[model samples]
Target chain A: MNNRDPENSPVIRLSDICFSYPGGPEVLDHLHLNVYPGERIGILAPNGSGKTTLFHIIMGLLFPQAGTIEIFGEPVRTEKDFRDVRKNIGLLFQDADDQLFSPTVLEDVAFGPLNMGKAKQEALAISRQTLSFLGLSGFEDRITFKLSGGEKKLVSLATVLAMSPRVLLLDEPLTGLDQDTQGKLVSILSEIDLTYMMISHDIDFLEATAEKIYTMKDGKIMVDEGLYIHRHKHAHMLGNMPHRHE
Target chain B: MLDEPFASGNSVIHRLDPRFRVMAAIVYSFVVAIVYRFPALGLALGASLTMIGLAGLAPGRVFYRLLLVNGFVALFWVILPLTAGGEIVYQLGPLDIQKRGIVLAAQITLKSNAILMALIALTATMSFATLGHAMNQLKFPEKLVYLLLLTYRYIFVIEQEYKKILRAIKIRGFSPGTSLHCYKTYAYVIGMLFVRASARAERVYQAMRCRGFAGKFYSLAEFDSSRRNYVFTALMTLTAAGILYLEYLPK
Candidate 1:
């Protein structure tokens, strides 16, 4: 929500970024938005409105047809650039299957550590600690593939959270979760100091969770002190939703 | 499927390390394979299946899911004896039933059942990673071990994709008759499966990349499986080995 003062900037900046899938229409139009660290930013858009595409563009998973993404102070140059950047940020996909490919929960969470070349024992310890944090203490030995959808999502976050990332990018993470889990997630998001970028159409989601919001439409983003309700556009709700005090 | 005669109580047999059980079964089965005797193999087979019943790992459901996996092999075994050219035991109308066919069929059934049951008795309920650790302790080839492990990881996914294709076929009103169009659709489905699996592999690989995966797999084993445990396993393995030696041998 802090748009004017650059001195106390929460996060870095993103200038006019445009992206589209191969043979698909321009999903994310010329978009420009600034998100501060410690802010839960929700990108509210329709189903095919390129919400995920924009997130991917930020994560450097998908290169925008045109635009720049700056993290902190450095520009993300290539896939290698995103490697270190990823350590600072975690992207939790809508589908847990996309992230939790390991056979067991411990292995799944330890994946981030394994990537960092942490020793087997050390990785297991980190994973176990994270699991407990996510209230999955006894599930370390359980098979991740056999876990319930809600459990899978929890483990997926546990995997990323184990890394202690500076930013978290979540794509419709509350899709299949029950109300209890949704409530828990809201609290967890609030307590975390990392910058969070979420894509969801749940308007109440923005109000309850995000500190700042951005609406992406026609490849452009507009900022409002309050989340503006708009119809007929890709990114419809970006800006702040009557900012809540921490 | 119903009884678990192999699942002994929480006594010595139940508490015996799975590594010991696996080693014992493997060594015993190898001996039986070499001996090639009817009565001894039969007794060993009976003993193995009995142990699985005792261990109590049977799913005990309407659909014997594990049994379904061996269906194709069972069918092959059932048909093999009929197809073989051997001494005729009887005639079912005009069709000949060979003695060799029946005995060989029995052997096929017994050997596989014995090996699988023994393993099931020991490892069915044991965590797969624990089993992998056992195999690693046993000095199993790393590549072969992960081959089985990865296959287990992906089999459900393959089955699910196949189920989806079949559902699509049912919705399209596919008939039993193998017409050109039907065959074409089947081919398309198969092709689609391969493409989808490949793409999934790519995405998974990308995800792995995001997490810093460098083309290596790590097994985090918490089980305290050391030399001391193996010393105890050695005794169990020797006993199972003795049973096989006594049961199956060339005259």
Candidate 2:
């Protein structure tokens, strides 16, 4: 079925998605999510809350037991369908080690473009440009395994961005990053004009980046329209009243 | 911590085309392995050491590697002289050191050290990525080359994961002992590492697929064989031939 539509269609639409690992509890049960163009969506949840499962289902890495996933209004069911979908969707794995498999930073960034049928020289050019864009110009020959954590994370993002995907799926992009690097990343990400759905527990970061916040709980999602600040009624010391620090 | 010690050097040997270096190292090692006499073995060892010097690697590191190799070769000295029966060269109480056994042990030690030195001088100077590209250009098996690349890339990550698991175990008051419980705990640690590695592999593969990786790996690395590569290859080949001639010539 030719389901191609206009560019304004929702970039990703999941309907009644249900997924369960074999012999395990259901992680995503009859969940529905819609991501529109130019939307920076954030999914916040604690460990084991199935936020990553939702991202996997959207990216076609994990197939749901019962659901229909549509990308750009095109229904996806087979590996071929996912292949087409992946051309426009980039995924940044939680572990940079998992994503950056090539020996050097340049080759790792060039991998996506090369696999997408770019010529060797063209892929190299694109990889170089992306690395420079990410402020990693001198890291072309640096070994991926030898890089610092922040550098590796930036290289991983460069690898994804080299593909020029329309939508990005970032899983815990802020984990293990220091404050300075996080601020640098935030500025870099702010300058990019792309839709991204990030899964992170950093509320301040999500608030700073995402246009909409979502909380995943018990295989369901609830929209969090307000700030995620929590208030308590009691103080740490008994018989002491809570007071704000000046 | 298993890093290639001399990989980041900026010397003549380090700058040679990796394909030529790989080919020359293999040929030199074969020549070293066949040399039995002391003179030929010494010549080969001198050449290997000279090349290592040209590579500009720290002499201390080279000696450390040589010491590591000789530690294993030291075993031959103990076993061979006692086992092989020949004309007695030295006697200590109840044991005889045979003349032929001593010669054989020396030959083995010389050959092993020469080959090890040649490899350290030639192959270890290039980064792993350069070596992989060289292998690809030499028509090495694609699957093996890809596997090597992935293994080199992820080995450190797996090591870090193993360390994390060990730290977790230690925090829980686990200590190594000869008890059955300790053995079980160690086994569980190894088993957990394997499980985590397998899961990470799966995630890595998925990430690859997400980025349009089918099965075959396409590398953007390009290597040009310059005059330096040809000169290096010729020099290594002549040295190897010289070693072979000296080893097999009639006395």
Candidate 3:
């Protein structure tokens, strides 16, 4: 199941992508990346390094100034062309509040399936199943805003999972989550079989879930495999410390 | 954090269908608003109080809400007796109180309280989500229902953002004052909030589009059709008729 075989075409390909905001300097300059099927890719970047902008470009929310964007081996340029791309790609936003707009957990989770023209009963069934899969079976009627931070993060992931997307684009999925919830999410991500590109700053989390990690700098990704430092006891200024290098 | 304080309950009113409860609240409020006779007003108020008891809401919270409403009503009690033209009832040095003004103010107090209590008992017993779905089921305009649901969803986010901005300023030893600098800083804070809110709104829209959201908001909430719904309708109808009879009894 090695998806990195050069013979197999990429599921997503961005070539010579250049983009900038109006009256601002370029955010992404000649960026290039390829995502293969069933490959879990992790991206590490500093704050304001256009990590989110890259995902937005892939989803066609923001068009690149110059680039050839291809999804599933087909070129995408307009909003009409991206409809299929959006349907097949599940994106988890950085802020769970922005992602979960419905008042209740069930409604938010069912939104994607319903938008795909699922019948009322079928969409509800899908929502329930997804929530249960995420260990949130009894939270169907809970108010979205009243949920704790960890619960809201899990529910937001459930909303994305209910879509049954072929590819996932996760932006800072564990930024503000608790340790227990982070462990829960890591296990869940490991169990799910899907092609995904995750943007995160937590090297330990990326090491646990992603097969390959790349760092983004100056609007382009650099393969940084050697950056993953193995966990070992090390001495610090005061005494012997058991901390991993950043 | 603003949460629904009264939505969680196991009382009879809480178990009734939200759609029917909404309709009942509308009809009862309209009836109470038009009935000016003391007997009818008294019956309406009693019915509202009974509804509150049936809902099983905490008396303390209910009284707090009433206090908030009566705080405004107290102003009417003070102004109407002095300014409204009517037969003089009392004189204090340079002031004359009128009997008609006192009666008018009393009518308003009763009417306002009755409507507010009935609304709390009927509609506020359900979560806002259920209420929104009930509105959709009852043929409320689709755009309006979406507006209600979206506003409910984002208001907390906006409030959190406002708090964060306030915290960022407070850590810098910022304090409130009547100086021009304070006013200017407050204006900048509001402006920044709007800017961040619009940015978040754009991101939310993009997220919705990513989930394949079309113009329609599909609701998974279902209203239960049970014996209780019918019972509620019958009870509300009887009360409305009784109040109507009381209103015209003397005639």
Candidate 4:
């Protein structure tokens, strides 16, 4: 994972990451991942496959029991350290509702810029620009809770984009989106010129937006470059017929 | 569904700045709460009703809100008039309704109704975001204001989560009954909901931190105190002063 020289540090580097819930089996066992500048990486994994936990560890939301995480060549340990790292990295939660906590879309989008110490007017200008970039110009005053699912997802992404982070980590972004919305999201994500790592099960969406794909299983991740094809077989309870799909 | 009953109305009262409305409601409620005499209480109630009418809310909605508030106050009517010892006004089976009790009940009813009506007319017209901004401008505790905003935003999501859990249980052919198994299952459902809510709170906190939240809420909405707002504030002050004088000063 650390094949690159120290002078040309990757955007994010994780080595020997091991984490588990207290008194529980390890969820991430010696996992290693490296994200370089301007790369779009997609991580595909089933539920409870430690993908989200890996994200939390990178974001400093959860501390790894044993690991070394480097964000832009700086080691992150304390809350203050994570604070600096977070300024450069933006994470989109799996649930848009969790991310858009403000009462209105404008406020939610402005929150990050304001927290970064921008003036109120400047933060608001940035928010408006971000929303407009996302093709949501007049949604500033919309109530967050009243938004449709796709609208909420877009607003949540707007909140992160308003921060202008160089690195984006998206978790299950296309889970509940309709096909049209997913297409729109793919286009929006493709146009952005930033390094991003997305965890999603939507194969077509990942193929369109991500340059590299990985799969997680049993607390380990491996590169997956082949086309995604799933096969399943089912037997009827009546024992009359069996069905299979490829 | 979450109801913003008066929030969408277009009226003079609805157009007033939320800060002025909040201030006016506080002063009006104080005046109502302090007034003891029936005449003064009646005056306060009339003022509240006038404001409500000016707000142009539906009559049936107003009546329903008043009924909901008075329903709790109605309990005091039955108990206080019978248990309170004073000059007997009426008699029922094994009970005597006292004159003091009737007066106390009337005072309670008038005060609660007047305050509730004033709040409905004044504060209910503004959206919660406007109300939060007004509170922040008034130097209200930032934590409490943020808590209010978050609660208002996430309550619907939590409700939906609860509904999903109940639907899952129903699909499993679990019908609630007056049995130990039913009670245990219900308790487990509540426990699971709590656990889920706790996990969501943690995730929300993480999301906030990822956006650089540092124990403070930064608001994008700014309220300007324009000439209209000043005029509204002045009128509210004058009305409140008059009410206070009428209720407290010698007539």
Question: Candidate 3: which pairs clash?
Answer: none
Better of 1 and 3 by TM-score: 3
**lDDT of candidate 3?**
0.91
Interface RMSD of candidate 3, in Å, is 0.9
lDDT of 2 by residue, A14-133 (tens): 898999999999999888887888888888888998998888888888899998999988899888899978889999988888898888888889999999999989999999999999
Ranking by lDDT: 3, 2, 4, 1
Assess each model's interface with DockQ, reporting 2 decimals per model: 0.41, 0.75, 0.81, 0.77
On a 0 to 100 scale, what is the lDDT of residue A223 in model 2?
63
Task: Chain B TM-score per candidate, please.
Answer: 0.68, 0.96, 0.97, 0.95
Candidate 3, residue B86: CA error in Å? Answer: 1.8
Per-model TM-score of chain A alone?
A: 0.86, 0.89, 0.91, 0.88
Scored against the true structure, residue B133 in model 3 reaches a CA lDDT of 91
Rank by DockQ (best first) = 3, 4, 2, 1
lDDT tens per residue, model 2, B1-251: 77887899789998888888998988888878877878889899889989988999998999899999899999999999988788898988999989988989999988998899899999889878888988988889999898898888888889999999999999999889999999999999899999999999999999999999888788676777789999888888889888888878898
Query: Which digits, one per residue and each the tens of the lDDT, describe model 3 over residues B46-95?
Result: 99999999999998999998999999999999999998888998998999
RMSD of each: 6.8, 4.6, 3.2, 5.0
Give lDDT per model, in order. 0.72, 0.88, 0.91, 0.87
Candidate 2 residues lying further than 4 Å off, grouped into runs, are A1-7, A223-246
Which scores greater on DockQ, model 1 or model 3? 3
My TM-score estimates for the predictions, one after another, are: 0.77, 0.91, 0.92, 0.92
Off by over 4 Å in 1: A1-12, A16-18, A28-31, A65-67, A224-246, B1-27, B39-43, B46-103, B132-200, B226-251
Candidate 4 DockQ, CA atoms: 0.77
Error of 3 at A58 (Å): 0.6
lDDT of 3 by residue, A1-246 (tens): 343567789999999999999998888999999888988988888998899999999999999999899999999999988978988999999989889999889989999999999999999999999999999999998888889988999999999999999999999999789999999999999999999999998989998999878778889877655754456765678556555557
